[model samples]
Target chain A: MRRAGVVALNTFREAVRDRVLYNLVFFALLMMAAAVAVGQISIGIEQTVIVSLGLSAISLIGLLISVFIGVALVSKEMDKRTLHALLANPVRRWEFLLGKFAGLVLTLAVNTAAMALGLLLVMIYVKHSLERSDAVVLVAVYFILLKLALIVALALLFSCFTTPLLAILFTVGFYIVGLYVQELRNLPVEVMSPAMTAFTKGLSYLLPNFENFNVMAMAAHGRAVPGALILQNTVYTVVYCTIVLTAAAAVFSRRNLK
Target chain B: MPGLAIEIENLTKEYPFGFLHLKKKTSLEGLNMQVETGEVFGFIGPNGAGKSTTIKLLMRLIFPTAGSARILGKPISDVEMHRDIGYLPEQPYFYDYLTAAELLDYFARFHDLTAADRKERVERMLKKVGLETARKIQLRKYSKGMLQRVGLAQAILHDPKIVILDEPMSGLDPVGRREVRDIILELKREGKTVMFSTHILSDAEMLCDRVGVIVGGKLRGVGAPGTLVDMKTQGMEILFELRGTSNAPLLSKATRTGDCYRLQVAEEELYAAIDQLRAAGARILSVAQVKATLEEFFTNLVEADGTHTSAVEVSGK
Candidate 1:
């Protein structure tokens, strides 16, 4: 566990020194500033516009960072031959994989928190006063983070067995499919063959249900998220990420690394 | 077995290529070798001769297709055994975003070093590898030689009993190579077992206590550098200066340049030739014996393998 922490800290240092978080955070803040400008032009619903645009910007930027960086997490080490020296140490292969996952999650968390804070500051600047319901925005930001963590795990799993470019495609593909998994689960059985219906149903359960974590609409409306839904999303993300990371470790441990 | 630092038995690695990895290419074939404690063992081979593959298998960076290996009486599969082992891969690449000190400190943490120990060790290792001046600079801006020095520093940061390096002298200038050579010698003096692979036979001849010459995915020879080559005297060359030309039959065959005649003769004929030259009043300058070298032995092994396989194919056909 200590060795894994070492690798994790080194990975975090690499991301920060590479200046990846800075560029993404700068752009996210810029988008929130734009949202504030757009909010001023609207006669009413200015808070709604800012809330919706700001949350969307945060989520979109977080997704971009998670998917792009997550896909390269393992592949970059292998490509650069850094894994050679690192794995040669006493550290276990699974530990290294776990460390990489945790490190990227940390980066995402920090990036998300920065963007979330920016969104709140933008809100305060425009509203000239704070609202009691404004606290729900933090909940919305937390949901986005949960969604990004799941995406990072998916990207890491793809990275373990495939090239970075292919990993990115697969992760994004799964995310796109995952967003509409409810529709797949509800496809009309009357028009479909029995096997097709069964296949779609199976895939709907197998793929992550990202829609469960979407709370931007609820937050924008200044409504409280149900405690039950929060519990479910948290549990779901944990279970899904554990399984995906375990699969990644298994694949990585047996890989030839040639 | 008690004194052995590494032991290998029938180690093999066959890489699968082609569509769906159906075709197999043998990178290493049933390699069996050992390195004793506190000796510098050189793994010498030409390109694609399985030297790096063998090292990688020993380091557990890659799994073997067949056979097993043990280090310090523990199986290669034992992660704990790695605590006593340090490895540097060929043309090692590190996280270039890290400075030299940070890189070493990060690696030192893997050994479970205390904070104070890590700081002290990182500084000492940087100085050991002659990177103290550039320890603060990120590796991305380092030269190839400087990066190689950092690779060396990280490998030995934990002060492992056995150090395995693949091509440790590569990508270095002459002075850098000499410094690395001195470090290896220093490690040996400290009673640390060192195993390194290189294609540069001269370096092996200079540093290795014993060398294993690998060729075509096979070990062609293994022994002390001098013992691996033919020790029998091939011939004797005598250099002499004659005041005037003589009709001595041996002297007539001698090649003359700058008032010196050089004559090469069989060991049996050396004395007779010397006697005849003396009779001709020739002044002997020097006498030396010619013997096969490690370089020649290495080249012959490579060429012999090529021809030997081709001959077998022709004969079978």
Candidate 2:
């Protein structure tokens, strides 16, 4: 655990020093500024439009961080030959993978926090006052963090045994499928055949239910998030991340660094 | 076996490439060698001769397709064994964003060193490798030689008992190579066992107490430097200076070796060859033994086909 923490801190320092967060910050600012312009034309729904656009920007950029940085976490180490010296240490392969995951997750947390703060400020500027229900967006951002953590784990898993290009393709494929899993599961039983129903149900269980974390619309329109749903999303993210990380460690342990 | 730093039995690695990876490319083929405690063992081989592959196996950076190895009587696959081993890879790459001091601190943490110990060791090691002045500078700004020094520092920062270096002297100038040689000798003086791989025969000859000649993923010979060099010998040749013009028939077929004439003679013809040289008016300069060198032995091993490698097995202490 100590070794993993050390690795995690080192990785976090590398990301922080690399200034990767600047691009996300710039995009968030652009998103908020653009929301102001778009909200000006839709004067009646200024707070709603600004909050919607700002939250979307924050979530998309968070996903970008999880996918892009997470893929390179292992692949770049191999390409640069840093893994040679690192894996030679007393550190276990699982600890190394977990360290990388923890580090990137911490980074995502910081980035998301920055974006959320930006969203809050933009909302205040548009509405000229804070709404009693405006605090619900924190719940949405919290879920965004959980959702992005799962994406990062998936990216790390694919990158453990395959190329970054292929990992990205696979992760993006799962991402698109994850968003439509609800619709696919709710397909009209009257019109669908038995085989299609079984296939969709099996896939819904096998693939991550990313839609579980999608509270963007509710938070933007200032609706209450149920306590039970928050707990469920938390449990789901933890379970899936653990399974994927274990699989990554297994693949990484058997690989020959030739 | 207790004092052995490294032990291997039938170590092999076959890398799969091509479609579905069904076709196998063997990188190491049944290699067996050992490094006894307190001795510097040089693993000498040409390029693509499985030196790095063997080191990687010992470090457990990669899994072996077959066979097993032990470090300090523990299996190589055991993660706990890594605490005693230090490795410097061929042209090692480190985190360029980290300074020399920061990199050492990072690697030192794996050994469970305290923050205080880490600070002390990182500073001492950087100074030991002559990088104290540039300790604050990030590694990306370092020159190749400086980076090599950083690699050396990180390898030994934990003060491991067994130090394995793949090609420690690869990118350094002569001065840097000498410093590394000195550091290696220091490690030996402190009673730490060292195993390093290099294609530079002269460096191996100067440093290794016993050198292993590997070619085509097999051990061709293993023994003291002079012993392997003495294993192969052509017939002895008598050398004499060419004086005026040689008229004798015995001197007719002599080959000129610069200012001296070299003539191959049987061991029994010692007196008769001298008599011929005197009668032919050739001046006898000196008689010196022409023993083979490690380079010649290594060259022969490299040039030998797959069918000719020796089956000599050198085990642990």
Identify the leading candidate in terms of lDDT: 1
Candidate 2 colliding pairs: none
lDDT of 1 by residue, B256-291 (tens): 897899999998999999999999899999999867
Model 2 TM-score, 2 decimals: 0.94
Query: DockQ of all candidates, in order?
Result: 0.83, 0.82
lDDT of 2 at B220: 79
The C-alpha lDDT values of all candidates are 0.87, 0.85
TM-score of chain B of each: 0.90, 0.91
lDDT of 2 by residue, B1-317 (tens): 43778899999987766679897667788888888999999998877777877888888876788899998999887888888988897899999999999899889889988899999999899889999899999999999999889889988989999999989999899999999999999999999999999999999999999998888678878898988888785445777887577677767767886668887765577778888888877788766566778998888777775532321111100
